[model samples]
Target: MKGMIVSRPTEGDLPVSLDDLGAAARERWGAWVTERHTSVVPNAVLTLEVEPPGEPEFTVEVMRGPRSINLDGTPVQNYATAAWLRSLMPADAPRVIVFDDAWSMHADLTYGCTAEGLRAGTVDHSVPGWDAGDPDLY
Candidate 1:
């Protein structure tokens, strides 16, 4: 259930400083986020565990770069969770893209967030030789 979260902010809307993005994982994930022992790449990353009570717990590698924080973890299976994730995006972010590995052509898992709202769709994994028509055949 791996995935990538990317956000690109406009020049005029960029945060004044990286520090302006907030300092705590709680700021982004709320009180459910807990610090844990996990190694990350040699970059500014926050390794934490998100345990939302009854829901399955997952690891989140929040990589903060010069502009936005990159969130790496599992994909949301429902629209409620997707909307929650979108709500956490920084105000400077004009568009937020999320790519989920468990996505299907009919699943509304892979999506993007913008002023227009959450735009969800599928990823075209169609390859030249893998055009079998039957999805499972691939």
Candidate 2:
């Protein structure tokens, strides 16, 4: 006898911040660079839209993290992350697949799931959106 497994897709929002990402990386790797140090590094906050085979869009944040400077929260689990990515699939889209880090723990579970997609290359990375620049920070 043969068995088959099927998964369904889900839809929701995902929030992310770079504020604690640097610290987290440093904590895990002992050495890490802040986003400000990398020209390619995205802004501190972002909202990613996920849809299988479809381009994802990045929206800027109107407000900063609760801490004002850093974020605080629990990281998303691998299974939950994978489920969220699967939810982004269209009826005919291929099975959602992902493998990456989970850094947006401070973000809601939904957002954390989406972050997985972002890291896994499941979501589009070409969206041109970012928070307004602050001269003081620069």
Candidate 3:
């Protein structure tokens, strides 16, 4: 049986620092979040990976320079789409709100979904982001 859960800080509730965001996400994601590994991409780009349990994970990647973000991993079936994730994020103070909020995690749970139905896929095969277990994420 395969399953997937996707969640992030609700609107108006964002984290201050990148580290804080990751930690907050880990906690909200529940006990599934295990070890964390940090890998930076030279300057401002960073890639953080939590314990991977051979299941597809939802990832929200923020990049500097142009200051664009990419929500990768997971498919359109099991979890929330990239569009939904971005919309849920706070429009103002994405950083400060996360740290201040209590539970900043939003999940896509389909009621009456069986374990088999929970199996998710990828949104983009050409280029996948971090959480989805795609190498191009970093």
lDDT of each: 0.43, 0.28, 0.36
Q: Which should have the higher TM-score, number 1 or number 3?
A: 1
- Clashes by residue pair, model 3: 7-106, 8-106, 14-97, 14-98, 15-95, 15-98, 15-99, 16-95, 75-121
Of the candidates shown, which would achieve the greatest TM-score relative to the real structure?
A: 1
Runs in model 2 with CA error above 4 Å? 1-13, 32-36, 40-138
- Per-candidate TM vs. native? 0.47, 0.21, 0.33
Report, for all candidates in order, the number of backbone clashes.
0, 3, 9
Q: Which pairs clash in model 2?
A: 9-87, 10-87, 14-111
lDDT of 1 at 41: 52
Worst 10 residues of 1 by lDDT: 102-111
Error of 3 at 62 (Å): 2.9
Candidate 1 lands at a TM-score of 0.47
Give RMSD to native, each candidate. 8.1, 17.7, 12.8
The lDDT-based order of candidates, best leading, equals 1, 3, 2
Model 3: residues >4 Å from true position, as ranges? Answer: 1-20, 34-44, 50-54, 57-59, 77-88, 91-138
Question: Could you give candidate 2's per-residue lDDT for residues 1-138 as a string of tens digits?
Answer: 011111212222222234443344345324222233322324434221212223222111112231112121122333333344334334444222332223111121232345554434332223332112522110
Which scores better on lDDT, 2 or 3? 3
